[model samples]
Target: MSIAVAVISSDTEYVTRMMSYMKGSPIYHTWRLQLYTNPERIHQLTELERMELIIVEEHLHSSLLRRLQAGGGQLDELVYTSKRGAIPIIVLAAERRELLEHELYKFQSVSALLHGMQQRYERFRSGHAKKRLVTDDRQQTIAFCSTLEQAGKTVMALHVAALLASKGYRVFYCNLERWNTSDSFLAGRVLQEQAASYSDLLYVVKSRQNASKWLAEHAAAVEEYSFYMLRPFQHEADRRGLTTEDAQRLVAAIAESGLFDHVLVDLPAGLDDWTLPLLQQCHAHYMLLLPQPGWQRKHQLAMSCVERHNAQALEELQHKRLLVLSEPYGNCQPGSSVSDLESLPYVEAWQQGDPVLLGSVHYRAAVERCIQPLLTGEKVV
Candidate 1:
């Protein structure tokens, strides 16, 4: 089904227009177009490798067509535009037929002729009834927070997005670190253009910058956060770069965007200054963990952040369950294992929290195992 189509015409505009139409056709997925802007290049393709179709304009030098015929180029079809027509030539001319008959006899291989090539393609596609699949609403967003030490967040986000999209959700991969790469906002434009279709928009929030830009870009998606943190960043110096107030504004904007019915914010390890404020902003918060020795340190921070933030936010935080990211990279340090996480005392302490323990996600292939299932609503092993 993969056919190569060559358009031989000096009018790049017409060539481009024809190709554009071809690209959107049902056969488009089956064919690839190559432009032969010069006649010499056309001569380069051997007879054995001639394209499936050769579209040429009559204005092209006669020597070029002779070169094509010499190259053993037997196109599946030839569409020629000229003031005169002959057998098998698709004549495109405003002039009378008498002028074309003389020229038409010069070519013997033309099998079919159509005056308007563009309209022919349209009729061909309509006869086939090629339906364009419109994106619909079934989007879901999940927040992913990993210790800054691991840059695995991006991998996790993209994996989930692809999985959900494959399963029929209008999934978006949001990158907070680089605001410009916000997928939800980018998808928003597509959603607006096809307003009749219901396409669920899932936004992955990685950081405050992600939230900030989504607001600025006016991306609409069902709000979902991997986690929400009160203290977005720790360094007092970095705090000056963006404030809690700015984050709050972005949060409000997201809430109002109609992007998601559920928003999950992935919280970073340890409740810092941003923890309380962020918890207050979200409808839900999850104390995500990777059952390891660090749980002890993480537990203390979580408790402190939950308690100090506000009783209500703390209750909200407590009600949220422990989301154990079971998957660990296979290349973990030789000695690292799940048992290392089980021994952490903080796990037991967390069990007694306000939200209570939600159960555990055993380490597995996070993207292929965990993320794909979550996005696709399919069971993961």
Candidate 2:
């Protein structure tokens, strides 16, 4: 999904620099740039070529505002009444102003400028009641699952969540593993006086009540980790009655809450009523495989079961799933059967169960490498 963006600047050199930076960046594939040196050219853009965002120089912004005023219209009207609907216009100023909204310093790094544009665009879309042509506004839900236990699915998921949070994205991490031990690793203050447990959450979901409101009020925010999570279930039995519908509804509530940019779900090993729904609901699936023997056989058996129960779900998983080889150490080689899969470098220190190790510089670099494809919009075939 390429986002159409127009860069309107009278300075030809500035426009060229912006184009060069975007072409070299990881987001090149996701953003389609339309450069306009003459601000008046914006009026000539056809309906099909309408932009989702416009980056205009401060001087040109003033001219555009004057034009709007002459026509008995305001800048807000120009944004909401566009043929393509609700295009966010960002002003590129000479210097940064703390009180200014939707403004970016033009002389900053390309990455910083692009990040500001995205932030403002997101804020505008969320706050305004206007229609948009692009449909990528929904929060992304990514699930990490594996066929074998102790495959570092939870750890990897948390690391990825932390990485996104560090990039200034609001991330929500949900541990759906039956034997969830997230409490041991993520220790933080609960949001409410008495944090509502997963059982309470499931009950709200099952009753078809206001699950989003309940989650917003009860979800625990780990400030140190910079993410939100649900209180882990006290006992494995507490998750025994979680039906497939319940799982789907729970995930829907979280994603639709409009409170997070990404939702990371750490699913239990293997497919069942509970895990299958989550896999189906998630936008991307990271299936972790160990370099040990029988890994392929285990995955094959799991897919066979999924096919037998739900063929549609099986097809969806295949299209969005990324096969990952989980190595025990840095020098460990993946087995012949999984040699072609992407692998995560082993963090031997994490085995010590020190939660602080999860935030170590080395560990984050490993996780970043594993998830680079996701960041670059690369498809897994």
Query: On a 0 to 1 TM-score scale, where does candidate 1 land against the true structure?
Result: 0.35
User: Over 4 Å off in model 2, which ranges?
Assistant: 1-135, 187-193, 234-236, 304-312, 328-331
**Number of backbone collisions per candidate, in order?**
42, 0
lDDT of 1 by residue, 99-203 (tens): 432122213212222224334443332322212111124223345453333323333444444434433333333333422222322223223333211111112
Maximum-lDDT candidate = 2
- How accurate locally is residue 341 in candidate 1, as Cα lDDT from 0 to 100? 28
Best by TM-score: 2
C-alpha lDDT (0 to 100) for residue 168 of candidate 2: 62
Off-target runs (Cα >4 Å) in candidate 1 are: 1-142, 146-154, 172-174, 177-240, 259-269, 283-286, 301-312, 326-381
* Local accuracy by lDDT, each model: 0.39, 0.71
Write the residue-wise lDDT of candidate 2 on 1-381 in tens digits.
467887778899877877788788867877888777755665644532377777778888876655544554335623624444456778888866772787788888888988878778766754552222112567778889987687878878888887777656788888778786665455443344367777787778778788778877877767676788877664557677666777777778888988887888888887766677788788888888877666557777877887898887777778778777777544344346777766676766656765652656666766877765555455754
